[model samples]
Target: MASKLTGTVALVTGASSGIGVDAARQLAEQGAAVALVARRKERLETLAAEITEAGGTALAVEADITDRDQAEAAVRQTVERFGRLDILVNNAGLMLLGPVVGADPREWERMIAVNVQGLLHTTHAALPHLLKAAEEGPRQVADIVNISSIAGRQAWENYGVYNLTKFGVNGFTESLRQELAGRHVRVGVLEPGAVDTELGSHNNATIHAEMLDPFNAQHERLVPADIADGITYMVTRPRRTAIAELWVMPTDQA
Candidate 1:
């Protein structure tokens, strides 16, 4: 039997680690030619090689999506390699949890740059190709899945700026979904709660031990592949269907 994405192409940003890596692999497994975009060239190459060895087509595109030019170039490279783009997973993000009062302004800048600007740049670049794919490619629909967080929907004390960025992602996704509906470009947001990934490791030691560690030890968090499954499910649905938002949380998380 043919796979769900037999003739499609996908580009996943932040593909060097965590959710991005698994998402790219799952997309490739469904027979899509995937392009992995991340700042870490070596990790991207390794993943590309792993996917190839597993009988899937994959390309590594080293790029920092915060830079508009690099983001556009990444999109161009993916299209050039695969001929068309059918899916875009904007998965690059940063989470630095700390009290707003004494926080380093630099952390906020980094989060905003990667979580907000990076997503915007990559989406802007990929939209044209995705619209083209919806019109001309085998599938009559194309998809954009933005990886957000439960923080988007709820506010936490230490997660102030992270919450802001994710909330923005959710809002942008909904607005874009409406704007692109006529074009058959399905836009959706996946909000994941407490995943055991490198996403939280960027925080300083004080915050990590005080804020993240206790929560992690108490909760059975979601995994990278769990979120990947959500991504695949959203993108592989029938052309007549569109999922606007998906929130994935650990069963034990309240």
Candidate 2:
């Protein structure tokens, strides 16, 4: 039997746009109170308003998950406002693609900070509350869904650093799932391929001109909602079933 998410509270990072935004809306539709976190306050406020007007509960939490203190505070604020945290979607990430040689080192640093450290910061802060909710909240199981990418499974030449961060996410999620299985905290990694997101726009001019344009041209891209549907399915599974990982790609891509 599928588990219903009624009366549950879910915290979603990067809720300002793309897959995160779609996932937040979907969770609300499934009867969960959503805490939307993002660096863009206005965007978060707008999304929250839309959800609330549709008869769902939403909170706009403005925080850059890259900062450890801000990440912890986001989790604390969600628990304070909603009384518990039943689900955490670590969807905030920075994707900068370029070749390792002669690439702007700063871009690599930013990617690591946001993609890897940011996930760790939020997950660490939310883990305790998630475990508590699993033990005593309305739902007997809690979930932590980390958004990885298909790049995690296979590396591309110019996308080296981005692939590194995603691969790290995959390993970290698997390890966390093993550690938390006994506690009923389900940890999952969602790997998506060639999604039509703002991800490529973050690349430097050199890489964008030389690599991104060509790569995007050849791929049959997916929409953000497609990835959100995968997340919804994973979280809605019965307590006895945990979807450890999912890989989603455009049907015509391969």
Candidate 3:
């Protein structure tokens, strides 16, 4: 039997680690040619080799999605190599947790750059190719899966700017879903609660000991593959079905 994505192509950002790495692997396992994008060239190359050894086509495109030129170039490279793009997973993001008062504005800027502006740049570049793929490719559909967080739905005290970025992601996803519904481009947001990824390690030591450490000790966290499963499910749905917004949380998370 053939796989669900035998003729499709997918581009995954932040593919150097965690959810992005697993998402790329799962998509390739389902037979989609995958382009892995990240700043860590060595990690991306290793992953590409691993996928290729497993008999799945993969390409490593070193890029920082925060830069508009690099983001667009990554999309162009994917299409150039794979012929067309049927799915785009915007998985690159930053999480710097702290109170709004006396917080580092630079950290907030970084979060906004990677979380909000990065998503926009890649989406803008990939939209045309995805639109074309939806109209003419074998699947006759295209998908944009933005990896958000549970923070998008609820505001936590130390998660102000991170919350803002994710909330923005949810809002943008909804608007795009509506606009592209008629065009066969399905835009969806996947919000995962407290995953055991490097996302939490970026915080300052104070934040970690005071907030993150306790949270981890209390609640069972999710794995990268868990969120990757959600991503795969969203993109593989039949053309008539659209998973607009999916919230995947650990059972222990409230």
Ranking by TM-score: 3, 1, 2
Query: lDDT of all the models against the reference?
Result: 0.94, 0.91, 0.96
Candidate 1 lDDT tens digits, 143-219: 99999999999998988999999999999999999999999999999999989899988878988789888989999
Question: What's the distance in Å from true for residue 95, model 3?
Answer: 0.5
Number of the candidate with higher TM-score, 1 or 3 = 3
The candidate scoring highest on lDDT is 3
State the displacement of the C-alpha of residue 49, model 1, in Å, after optimal TM-score superposition. Answer: 0.7
Q: On residues 105-182, what C-alpha lDDT tens digit does candidate 3 reach at each position?
A: 999999999999999999999999999999997989999999999999999898999999999999999999999999
Candidate 2: stretches off by over 4 Å: 1-3
Model 3, runs deviating above 4 Å:
none
Which candidate number has the best TM-score? Answer: 3
**Each model's total of backbone clashes:** 0, 0, 0
Q: RMSDs, each prediction? A: 0.7, 1.7, 0.6
